[model samples]
Target: MSLTPLNNIGEFALLERLAKLINIYNKDKVIKGIGDDAAVIKPDIDLVQVVTTDMLVENIHFDLSWMPLKHLGYKSIVVNVSDVVAMNAIPAHVTVTLAISNRFTLEAIDELYEGIRLACENYKIDIIGGDMVSSNQGLIISITAMGYINKENLVYRNGAKPNDLICVTGDLGTAYAGLLILQREKKTFMANPYYQPDLQNYEYVIEKQIKPEPRIDIINKLRELNILPTAMIDISDGLSSELHHICRQSNTGCRIYEDHIPIDMMVSNIADEFYISPITMALHGGEDYELLFTIPLNQYDLIKNIDDISVIGHITDANEGMYLINNIGEAIELKAQGWDSFKKEE
Candidate 1:
């Protein structure tokens, strides 16, 4: 017998290996199983069901010193809800499970639930049920969100066609900027216990990191405008990485412009302060939780007036190749240089 490190093979590879071991019994009921953002189930003829789960662990996914328990609770739910929204589905219910150590108090657990309650209220979802268990390690939270969409309205990552307009909701890279600031502050505080972190200036980015809202509003707006996305995925990873998912799934290529990638001024300033490239951050920063979707070229005029959505690029023929045209007019092949949790850093 031999032992191998999971990090050496990486997350996607690990997933692929694990997926090969499973047997899908009910093929008709399981519309989608292991690949997409969520698992699609055909519970009925007219309606399609979506189930998505996200798990957050202490230190690996978050730091308790910087990440408040309340925010963690809220974020766990939001991230799962974002997956449902990525499928163009409305989240109706969620089940949350928590693993806590002796260090976590009853009051602390209540605080976490309060945040979950607030998110449920804001998102108009019900907390159906979940589990609570003891953990020898640190805090861990997992949320599974279930939602439904009409069979006709359901969108997947593989639906984009040539010439479809690529769109994204809100801005990108703010969460990574916030994480940098928090880590910097944490290091400072570790060196000096009396020092108080001046986080007022980095409020927006910090909030973006700690408390992210799912793109339910964008889903609602798209529905109201009668614009169904041809292909879509939530930017849980990075813009470039998610774009790769869409392009690979749809069997199409994309041409996004550097100038058109939307970024907030606050994020830009913070990146500048950190001596990092804003565009690079936008492309490779993870945990943005924004929706990346494509629409038919003709439908562009309808969504152009929508303030938050940005038309950054358009889908192209697979033979044309995926690219990012720089400001100086150079076509650079896009790469998925985003965060990989399982990767072992060289």
Candidate 2:
């Protein structure tokens, strides 16, 4: 085992050393590798290309304390894949760019890439090419994903119309509740050195926070049924935020039923322990990484039979605007007051 003088060697030197470690998935598609301003890849076939990127920063997006390097790498890919899934496309390739400070070592880098490489295998995506730079700040990982879709099958955020049904994939807010548990556990550890945090419980909630998968299967099923979302966006923001985006983009209004929002049983129990309503967690709590979109009213029965797809609401006339129809029938405005790490005061 050996330690790298990663700091003293400087950023460019580290990049030079790391150059040996990476290669394009297809040697032929790589017009240029690590040295240039960017790496270019030839488009596959006459297929339409979709591109998306995600950035993860230390402490803000991840904590090294409990997060395994493998899960972190897997998460980076999932976030990018979610963007492709939002577009109703199957993600086919990804390029990972990493920035490191003096804190990490060669062994640590291997663990991180080990996770990244495993995600490539699971998602059936190719690792094209990427840049490794040394930074003065803590670790940062930025991933760019590429996906392919038929021109006719493409889904975007700007297609909703009146009477379209609002649909979402899987459960929501489990990830958000899971995050609360993780942060609380992390705090407990920092407060008492002798106290071992009791994490005997909350495994399911924790798993959602740590390793989320993009809903590509649902996208495929929808396509198989000859259905296309009137409008679509991944649920990275809270449900309230996403619905608002669909409404604004498509020049439509929406109404969601409070009871229809999907929430997992484990998340519900944990939320009760924390004195939080699972519904509130799903509504305003972000990071579910699910898909939220609208479909035509006639397509409702076609989509409902599919497992995990929930018809939470529907698009309405422009005058109605976007709001949630509570169980008691009271209407409330939808607002997106989600996590804003960039705005936090140091």
Index of the highest-TM-score prediction: 2
Clashing residue pairs for model 2: none
- Estimate the Cα RMSD of every predicted model relative to the unseen true structure: 10.2, 2.7
Q: Can you give the TM-score per candidate against the true fold? A: 0.86, 0.90
Clashing pairs in 1: none
Please write out the lDDT profile of model 2 over residues 21-105, one tens digit for every residue: 5544545445666677776777667679899988899878888888888899888999999999899988877878898876787
Q: Give the per-residue lDDT digits (tens) of candidate 1, residues 234-333.
A: 9977999999999999999999999999999999998899899899999988888999999999998899999899999999999899999999999999
Query: Candidate 2: which stretches are off by over 4 Å?
Result: 1-40, 340-346
Q: Global CA lDDT of candidate 1, please?
A: 0.84
Q: TM-score of model 1 relative to the true fold?
A: 0.86
Candidate 1 has its poorest 10 consecutive residues by lDDT at 14-23
The residue-level lDDT of candidate 1 at 299 comes to 96
